[model samples]
Target: MTLDEQLKQLAIEAQCHLAKTPERQRSLSRLISIICQSNKLVRPFQGQFQGVYEEIYAEAQQRLFLYLCKEIDRYNPELEVMQWANFLMKKRFFIEASRDLLPTIPKGVDRSRIKRSPLEVLEKQTPIASQVNASLTEEIIQCIQEDHDRLFQTTHIEHKPAANFQYIALQFLAGYSWKEISEELDVKVVTLSSFYGRCLTKFAPKFKAYLSQ
Candidate 1:
């Protein structure tokens, strides 16, 4: 199958898989194995694999899964479930896995010998704290509003559950590394990295997209 066809199938499979299963052990296993195999291929072909694949993979596996799980557990979840599932599928299959096929270079040019300019290299690097802080602030504010709405509609609620992303984002923005966030959040470093990565992907794009509108 073509890559696009494969991705379409993958997204459908992912949705069906999530709908049938509440426990994610099987999903995690399949996704992690796919990721490890892709990482093996990608690391050796670093120049060819565009930089965003790793980030995209983390979102598919972690944040999207968490969001879906939350929806499944909710009492009345039709809207949230559909929205999150569609968003997750689009992000994984279309935005993440889908790519234009590059034509092979003609016999004369040495494609492997090409190098990035300084500006290109700089552009490839992530600007960590400032960007993370801005995104976290926005999500935190939204989460707080969500809490307010829930509390206003309900009675005798003690406190709203804090968003995992809000806590982690603020920790990283306050000069803590993934290790520190993991320690505070009581998760493994790998899990923390995965969560932070997924949140950042959704946060950055949504924030930028909103600004452009």
Candidate 2:
């Protein structure tokens, strides 16, 4: 089969694996293991298709797994197996990704609670919060939103999948070191640095406005 056809087949197989019911769990487990092993056959050609292999395959895997878990949940909401797997995989990814990017922030310190000081902004901006309080968190919310929008406008990321950008941002938020991010994301450290610098440059003005508020 052609590469495209192969990828399509992989997607279908992945969907099937993820949708396996409790009665078929063992069979599905063996099937997915085999598929993953077979797919690794392309590892030798990774130098030629690194980007496609990593980004495309990673996305496919995520979608397949998510779809499977979602399907299982639909069948039996009380079944915690799929949910546990989903959480475990997601948590590991976040922890591994963050371990290499930014410093870990302590919990319950008000990540979304905007602090006006330069020092605080320096620290808080590491893991950008998704939601800020409408009243007390308005400053951060507006600034991040503005900066995020501007970055999208200025970059070719507008053409890329939104999930790609979000994934990159999540790495930074997870406090992954730059080198770790480079390795994890399969990009050069310089590339990650430049991308982040662009984000900060676009975000700075908005951050200032937020502080002013």
The lDDT values for all models are 0.39, 0.39
**Model 2: per-residue Cα lDDT over 68-164, one tens digit each:** 4333333332333333334534433332222223354334233333224576346435542332111113344444445555543344233434324
User: The CA-based lDDT of model 1 is what?
Assistant: 0.39
lDDT of 1 by residue, 1-213 (tens): 643333333334444544433222233333333333343212212234354444334333443333333333332323432334445554432232222112343233345433345763463243333231213343444553354445312321124234265555545555454444545556655555655555555455444444344
Top candidate on TM-score is 1
What lDDT score goes with residue 34 in model 2?
Answer: 39
Give the Cα-based TM-score of candidate 2 against the true structure: 0.27
Superposed Cα deviation of residue 203, candidate 1 (Å) = 3.7
